[model samples]
Target: MNSLIYRALVELIQGLAVLMVIAYVMTRIPSFGDLLNRRLSLTHRVILGLVFGLMSIFGTLSSVDIFGGLANFRDLGPAIAGLLAGPVAGGMAGLIGGAHRYSLGGLTAEPCSVATFLAGLIGGFFYLCKKGRPIRIREVTAVMAGITLLHVLVITPLMLGLSNEIRQILKAVLLPMLLVNCAGVALFFFILQNLHRERLNEAEKHRIDSELRIAREIQMGMLPAPSRTGDPRYAVHAVLKPAKEVGGDLYHFFVRDENRICLAVGDVAGKGISASLHMAITQKLLKALAQSGEEPAGLLERLNRELCDGNETMTFVTLLVAFIDLRSGEAVLGNGGHNPPYWIRRGDVSRLVLEPGLALGIREQAVYTNQRLCLKPGDTLFLYTDGVTEAMNAHKELFGDDRLKTALLRVREKDPEAICRGIMEDLAHFVGQSEPSDDITMLVLRLESKEDAAAGAADGC
Candidate 1:
C-alpha cells in the first residue's frame, strides 16, 4: 500500500509538469493571445474553468489505474477545454490531471511519468493551437500519427518493463485511448471551423454598416437644402435619392455675389462608398474654385488638373458648372463629359448642348469651353444625373431621355419644387415595380422677373 501511494504521488508530479508545458506553448501562440484579448464573457470563462477542472480530476484518476486504466480518456476533456478557453487553460488542466493520477498510483518511474505528462502536454498544445479556427484534414491526420508514435515508442516500452501486469493493462488500454484522442481532435476542429466562419461574416457586416453611415452623412451634406437662396432671380429646388447607402451623385449652389450665382452638378464614375467619397471631394473643390470667381470653363480646367496631379486610381467625374448673371439674365455653362441641361419655354423644350471635354481627373492638360444661354422670362432649366433616364422598369425597359424630356415639358409651368416632384413621380411610374439601381438627382431652377415676384406676393394673402 505504501509503495502504491509513493508511485501515485510521483505520477501526480509528472502530470503537473505536463500541464505547465502545454500552458506555456498555448500562451506563446498569437491566435491564443487574440482570443484572450477579445475578453470572452464571465459566464463563458466560468464554464470553461469548470470543464478544465473536471478534466484534471479525470486525468488524475487515469494515472492511478483507477477504473481499469481507461482514465487516459480524460485527456479528451482537457483537449476540449483547450479548444474553448485556448491552449493555456487546456494545458494547465492536463498537467494537474496527469499529476493527480500519478500521485494516486505507484507509477512514479521516470519513463511512465514522463510519457503521461508528454501526452497531456501534446494534447493541450494541439487543442489551443486550433481554438476558434478550422483544422485542416491533413493537420488532423498528422497530429494523430504523432500521438500514436509517442505512445508506441515511449509509453509501451515503459509500461512493459515495469511489470507484466502493467504491460498487459497498458496494451489493453492503448488502442482505445488512441481512438478516443483522434475523435476528440476531430470534433474540436469541426466546431472551430464553424465558429471561425461565423466570426468572419459578422466582422464583414459590421464594416459595411460603419461605411454606410459615413457615406450617408457625406451625401446629405453635399446636397443643397430646399430653403437655400443662391439668388433671388431664380428659385432653386433639388432632391437626391440614393439607390444604395451612398452613391456617386452630387449637386451644389453658391451665391458668389449679388449678381452671380454659381451652380454645379456632378456624377462620379461608379457607385457606393468609393464613388461617394470622390463626389464629396469634387463638390468641395468646385465650390472653392467657384467662390474665387473663376470662369466656368477655367474652374473645370483647374479641377481636372487638381484631380489628375497625384491620383493613382482611375476615377473620373462628369461635371457641369454654370454661372448665372441675374442682372443680364445670361448664363455661362461649361461641360466636362456631362449630360446637357434642358431649357423649357412655354411647353417647348430645347437642350443646351456644349462642346464635350474629357471627364475631370483623366488628364491635367484637358481643357473645357463655355456656352452661353439667355434666360427668357418664365423659362425653366432642368439638370439631372443619368439615373433618371437610365432607370429600368419591371419589363427591363429604360426610362429614356425622350420620356424625361416629355415629363419636363408637361411640368414646365409648375413651381420649381412641384416640377421636381412631378418629374420624380413620372420616373417612378415609368419604372414600375423595379428598385432604383443608381443615385437619382434632379435640380430645377425657374427664372422669375422681379415684376412677376412683386405681383405674385401682392396677389397672395
Candidate 2:
C-alpha cells in the first residue's frame, strides 16, 4: 500500500507538470482574456469550453493507482475554469471528465463522477463571489481543499454503501490524494496569475510612453523658430537633444527693438517634466522682459530675482544672454555661471572671455557683468551647454574640451545648420552605445552682410 501511494504521488506530479504548462499557454491567448474580462461571442465561448473539456479529458486519461482504485486530478480542469472564467466553462469541463470516469465502470465510478461534476459548481460559486477579479492564494487553496473533501468524505460513502472494509480503504487513500491534487491545482493557478500581472504591467508601460511623447512635443513648441531672421545683421540656428526625461535647455533669438535682436542660451539643473516646465517659464519671462529694452546685465539681474522670488524648490539655471545692434558689429553679453562662447573670426576658433557670476536663482544677490565684443562680417559666436564636454563614451571616457576644440575647427566656414549638425554627429560617434546623461544644446549666431551670406552659401556654409 505504501509503495503504490508513492508511485501514485510521482505520477500525479508528472501529470500536473504537463497541466501547468498547458494552463500557462491558455491564459496567454488573447481570446482567453476576453472570456475573463469582456463578454465573449457564443462561438468563442463554446470554443473555450471545448478546450477546457479537452484538458479534463487528458486528466482522466492520466489516472494513477491509489490503493485498489484509480485516482487522478481530472476535476481540477473544470474547477479552475469556473474559478478563472465562470460557470459555463466549468460545468462543461466537469461534464466531460465525469462522463469519461463513469464509462470506466467501477463500484466507486458513480460517486467520483458526481463529485467531479460538482467541483466545477463549487469553483463557480467562488467565481461569482470574486466577480472576475484574480483569485487570491488563500481563497484558491481553501476552495481546492473543500473540493477534495467533498470527493473523499461526502459523495463516495453514499454511493459505495458504508461498510468497515470500504471505510478502511478510503481512510488510507484520502490524505495523499487530497494533498497531491490540491498542490497540482495551486501550481497551475500560480502560472495563470503571473500572465495576468504581466498584461497589466505592459499596459501601464505604454501609458507612460504616450504621456512622455506629448510632453516632449509641448516642450519643443515653446522655443523660438530654430532658424530666425529679423534683419540682415545676424542669422540664428540651433540644435537640441533632450535626455530620456526631457531637460531644461533653451535658446531664443528675437528682435528686442528696431536696432537690436537678443539671443540667449540656458540650461536648467535637472531633467523631466519639472525641468521642462522651468524651461518654458524662463523662455516666456525672457521674451516679456526683453521687450522692456533691458540690456543683458539688467535682464539677468531682474530674471534671477523673479525666478528666486517664489522658488521653494531652489532650482537654478546657467544662462548667457547677448544683445547685438543690427546696424553695427558691437554686441554686449552677460554670463550667469554659463560656459563662455567660442568666437570664430574669419575661420579662426578661440574662446570668448566672459567672467562668470553665480547661476540664476542660486542667490538673489548674484550680480551679472557685461562683456563687450566687436564682430567683423563673417564672425560667429558658437554657444553650447556643458553636455558637449561632459558627454560620455562606452568606456566611460569624457569627450573633453580638447576634442571639442578639434571638432569646432571642422565646423568653421560652414553655415549655422552645418556647424550644429557636424559637432552632434561627431559626439554621437564618440559616445557610441552609451546612454545620454544630460541634454545637449548648441546655437550659432553670425554677423553677416548680404555679400558675406552669399559667399558662405557657396562653400556649403
Candidate 3:
C-alpha cells in the first residue's frame, strides 16, 4: 500500500511537468491559443477537446496500479480542458481518457470511467456560467475537490465484492488523489493567467510603437517643404531634431508674395506627443494669420490671444516671427520669450536684440513689439530655440551662447544650407555620448542683392 501511494504521487508529479510543457506549447503557438477562446467554432473546439483527451490517455497509461484498479492523475487534463474550452471539449476529453482507462480491464473500470466523464461535465458547467470572468484559484480548487470526492464514492459500490482490498486502496490512495488533482488544477491556472497577461502587455507595447511611428511621419509632413521656394533674394534652410520619438520644435517658411517672405521658429513647452500637438496648433494659427499679411508684432499678439482662450493645460510657446522684404533687405521681427537670433554679415557674427514679451498662451492681453534689422547683400540670419544653447555634454556642461556664436563665425559667408549644417556638426561634436533632453530647431536665411544673387546663380552657389 505504501509503495502504491508513492508511485501514484510520482505519476502526479510527472503529469504536472507534462501539463506545463503542453501549456507552453498552447501559449507559444498562436493557432493553439486561439482554440481556447470562448468564441471558437464547434469543429475547432472538438479538435482541442480531442487533443486534451489524448493528453489524459497518456496520463492514464503512465499511471501506477493499486489493488484492482489504476491510480492515475488523468482527471487533470479533462477537467482543465472543460474549464478552459467549455462543456463539449471537456466532456470529449473525459470520454476519451475514461475509455483508455477501461481498456485496462480492472474491476473498478466502469465506475472509474463514469467518474471521469462526470468530472468533465461538472467542470464544463462551471465554465459555461463564468461569462468571460477570470476563474479564481479558490473556486477551481473547491470544484476539483468535489470532483475527487465524487470519484472516490462512485468506485466504492464497484469494490463491494472485494471489501478488504477496497478498504486498503481507499485508505492509501483516495486522499492523495484528491489533494493532487485539486492542487494541480490550481497550479495550472496560476501559470496560465501569468503567461496570458505577459502576452497582452507585449501586444499593447507593439501597438503603441507602431502608432507612434506613423504619428512621427505625419508630424514631419506638416513642416513646410524647403525646396518649394524659388525666391532669388532669400536662400533658406532649416533643421529640427527631436529628443524623443516626437517633439515640440517647429520651423515654417513661406513666400507670402513676390517681395515678402514670412518665417517663424517656435518651441512649445514640454515634450513628446502633447507638445507636438500644441506645436501643430501654433503652426496652423500662425499660417492663417500670416496670410492676412499682419506684421510680426500683430501676428504674434493674435496668436497669443487665440491660444490663451482654451488653454486648459497651461502650456506656453516661445515664438519668433520674421517677415523679410526680399527687394529691400529689410526685416521686421517679433519675439515672444524666445532666444535672441544671430545676424551673420560678411565674415562677422552678432546677436540681434529684440524686445521680449511673455510667451504665447501665458497672458490674455499680452502685447508684443517688432524689432527692425537690415540684411546686407550676402548676409545670413540664424534663428534657433533654447535647445541649441542648453544642449548638455557628457560632463553636464551646456553648449552655451559662446560656443554657438563661435561656431557661426566659423561658417560665416557660407550659404544658408552650409551654415545650418556647420552649426549642427559643431553641436553634435560638442555633445558626444550625451542624450538630448529637448527638441532642437534651427533656421538660417541669407539675403542677397539682385546682382549678387544673379551672379551666384550663374556660378551655382
Candidate 4:
C-alpha cells in the first residue's frame, strides 16, 4: 500500500509536469490562444474541445495504473477544459475521455467514466456562473475537492473486483489524486488567465501603432511640399523632424499673386498628437486668410481672434508671417510671440528684430506690428521653431543661437534645399545619440537677382 501511494503521487507529479509543457506550448501558438480567448469561430471551439478531450486520455495512459486500473488523475484535462473554455468544450472533452475509459474495461471503468462526465458538468457550471470574471484558486480547489469526494463515494460502492484489493487501492490513491488534480487545476487556470492578458495587451499595442501610422501620413499630407512652390525667384525649402509620431511645428508658403509670396512658420505650445491637431487648424486658418491678401500683421490679428473664440484647451501658437515682393525684394515680417528669423546676406548673419505681441489663442483683441526689411539679390531669410535652438545633448547642453549662426555661415549650398539639409545634418551631429526632446522645423527662402527673376518671369509667360 505504501509503494502504491508513493508511485501514485510520483505519477501525478509527472502528469502535471507534462500538462504544464502542453499549456505553455499552446499559449505560444497564436491559433490556440485566439481560440481559447473566444476570438475565433465555433469550429475552433469544437477543435480545441476535441484536442483537450484527447489530452485527458493521454494523461490517463501516462499515469501509473493500480488495482486493475481503478484510479488515476485522468480527469484533470477535462476539468480544465470545462472551467476555462466553458460548457460546450467541457462536455466534449468529458465525453471523449469517458469513452476511452469505458474501452479499457476494468472494474472501475464505468465509475471512472461517470466521474469524468461529472467533473466536466461541475466545471462548466462554475464557468457559467462567473461569466467574464477571472476564477480564483480557492474556487477551483473547492470544485476539485467536491469532484474527488463524488468519485470516491460512487466508485467505492460499485467496485466489482475482490473487496480487499479495491479498498486498498482506494485508500492509497484517492488522497493523492485529489491533491494532484487540485494543484494542477489551479496552475493551469492561472496560466490561462495570464495568456489572455498578454493577448489583450498585444492587440491594444497593434491598434495604437496603426492609428499613429495613419496620423503621421495625414500630418505629412497637410503641409505644402517644399520642393515645388510654383515660384522661380524664391528658392524655398522646409523640413519638419518631429521627435514623436506627430508634432505641433508647422511651415507653409504660397505665392499669393505674381508679385507677392506669403511665408509662415509656427510652433504650438506642446507636442505630439494634440499639438499636431492644433497646428493643422492653424494652417487651415492661415491659408484661408492669405487668399484675401491680408498683410502680415492683419493676418496674425485675424488668426488670433479665430483661435481664441472657443479656446477651452488654452493652447497657443507662436507664429511668424512674412510677405516678400518678387519684383522689388521688399519683405514685411510680423512677429507674434515667436522666435525672430535670421537674415543671411554677404556671408553675414543677424537675427531679424521685430516688435512682438502674445502668441495666438492667448489674448483676445491682441495687436501686432509689421517690420519691413529690404532683401537684396543673394539674401536669404531663414525661419525656425524653438526646437532648433533648444535642442539638448546628452550632457544637457543646448544648441543655442551661436551654434546655429555658425552652421548658417558654414553651409555651402546656394539653393534653399541643400542649405536646410546641411543645417539638419549639423544639428544631428551636435546632438549625437541623444533623442530630440522637441520637433525641429526649419524654412529657408533665398531671394534671387532682379535680372534672374525677370528672365524666370519671361520663361513662365
Which residues of candidate 2, in runs, are more than 4 Å off? 1-7, 131-134, 450-461
- C-alpha lDDT of all candidate models, in order: 0.70, 0.81, 0.82, 0.83
For model 1, give the RMSD to the true fold.
9.9
Model 3 lowest lDDT segment of ten = 452-461
TM-score of each: 0.66, 0.91, 0.78, 0.77
For residues 33-90, what per-residue lDDT tens digits would candidate 4 score against the true structure?
Answer: 7667665356765776788798889867876777775456678777777777677777
The lDDT of model 3 is 0.82
Colliding residue pairs in candidate 4: none
lDDT agreement of model 1 with the native: 0.70
> Which scores higher on TM-score, 3 or 4?
3
Q: Best to worst by lDDT, what's the order?
A: 4, 3, 2, 1
Writing each residue's lDDT as its tens digit, candidate 3 over 1-461 gives 67778778877677667777776766778776555544777897688689879877876776667776666667777888788878898899999988988787777777778878777878888999997788998999898888888778664555454477776766666866886788788887887777778778888989998988888889989998753346667788898998887899999998888778887899999999999999999989999889987898999999999999989988999999999876666789999999878998768899987888889999989999988876666788899998899999999999999999999989897888888889889989999988997889999888765796545444432
Best by lDDT: 4
How many clashes in each structure?
Answer: 15, 1, 0, 0
lDDT assessment of candidate 2: 0.81
Per-residue error for 136 in candidate 4, Å, reads 8.7
